[model samples]
Target: MGKILGIGLWVCIVTLGAVYGSIYLATAPAGPSEEDAKKAALELIRGEPITIPVIGGGDVTGYFLTRISFMMDKEKVKGQTLPTTELMTDQLFTLLVGNKMVDIGNVSSFDVNDFREKIKTEMNARLGEGMVDQVLIEQLDYVSKEAARKSADGGSRPMETTTVVEGEKLDEQPASSGH
Candidate 1:
């Protein structure tokens, strides 16, 4: 009886060891090494900056020359989750050009965080999910038509406005009914 009990105890210990070992292996963080992570970062797909002129600011007189970039995961491209690059850029162009992001009052009045979130959300939806990892504000410049014109060759138009998005127009808010 003593021999049997001793053997049973040994088996129980081994069983617990096996279970814990397996659990540890299964749950361990399996991220790549630092070198690999850096390599992946270096190889990330960076979308072109979407530059546009924002044209309405309550009483403010200048337009926001905004530029935004999207950094996407390469795996998205490999896994067929991201669409063609041209399509992505087109969609981004449409979003920026069609956005209701005029100055409102001044640079301080524009909610960059809100705009960023909206771009991320809507862009992902347009791309069919997981296409863009981040939407970065590469540049935001505010210049009045006059300033832009002055900066140019005294005659050329301030940077020509991009073509309107093919499928959509700038959304106009309905006039409020005076109470």
Candidate 2:
């Protein structure tokens, strides 16, 4: 009877220890995640404002004027040529023209978060996973075709673009003459 009791006690102790160990492990805080790694050593690269014309029903309706900026991994982009301007332009065209993401008539219904997430996903896929930490919208607005035409007739000069990297101005160039 004593041997039986000893064996039972050992089993119970072992069971308890196993349960405790599993619970502790399950509740323990995890180490730094993939998102944390992406956040490390980030560099801010602000691109020029891109103007995308919105066409619908066989005519030009309006334009999507947006300034796209990014938080990129400094270490990962150290030796690579980041074609952010070209990529962003292509993506914007795809989203605005090809996908018809934004409805000009119902501007308030646009989902800004979804737009940002899609841009980030597409950009990261092209640049490599986790290369683009965040896609930021510094400016986003819509200009009606009539409004744009009026602005042009009023002799408003086009704004110049300046590439800003890490809060420092890199270079300046004239905005594209094309709409």
Candidate 3:
């Protein structure tokens, strides 16, 4: 009877611990506010025409130049349009391209969350205590129009290559070979 009570107590303690742990993990606080986002956006735009590079391999050349518009509190601001413009031959644009190429070299994927966080960090650095409501990519694409035209003519870019194998074939050959 004593052993049974000990086991029951142990089980109860473990269950309570698990419940609390799950609750703690589920309710983590979110970062920043809409007001903060707007402030950050405004601060970032002050240095306007921020260009970032789109990194790729093999026959891909060039970077992306981004022009920041305004930063408004998501909850407070109503009906805003993002800005867009063709690649320009401006000094700021050139600096943006160079900085982006050095910063995001050979990156294959662009996660939106990661970009937003980066923008937030940058804004914080530029405007101490002020935060941007959001980082709107307003315009994002490869900088090389020539490369884009070439890809269009080829029907597919180099990054689309993939290998496929059937389940039955996998059993007959090394898993690494796929067939």
Give the lDDT of residue 159 in candidate 1: 58
Q: Which predicted model would earn the best TM-score?
A: 2
- Model 3's TM-score against the true structure: 0.33
- Model 2 is weakest, by summed lDDT over 10 consecutive residues, at 159-168
Better of 1 and 2 by TM-score: 2
TM-score of each: 0.51, 0.60, 0.33
**CA lDDT of each prediction against the hidden true structure:** 0.57, 0.68, 0.43
RMSD (Å) per prediction: 13.9, 10.2, 15.6
Which ranking of candidates, highest TM-score first?
A: 2, 1, 3
Clash pairs detected, candidate 3: 36-131, 36-132, 37-132, 37-133, 38-132, 38-133, 40-131, 40-132, 41-132
Instruction: Give the winner by lDDT.
Output: 2
For residues 71-132, write the lDDT of model 3, one tens digit per residue: 33333222223221221113334434434432333435545567555655565444332434
Give one digit per residue, the lDDT tens place, for model 2 in 112-179. Answer: 77888998888777668887777777777667787777777874765322222123233344432111
For model 1, the stretches where C-alpha displacement exceeds 4 angstroms are 1-43, 55-63, 79-85, 155-179
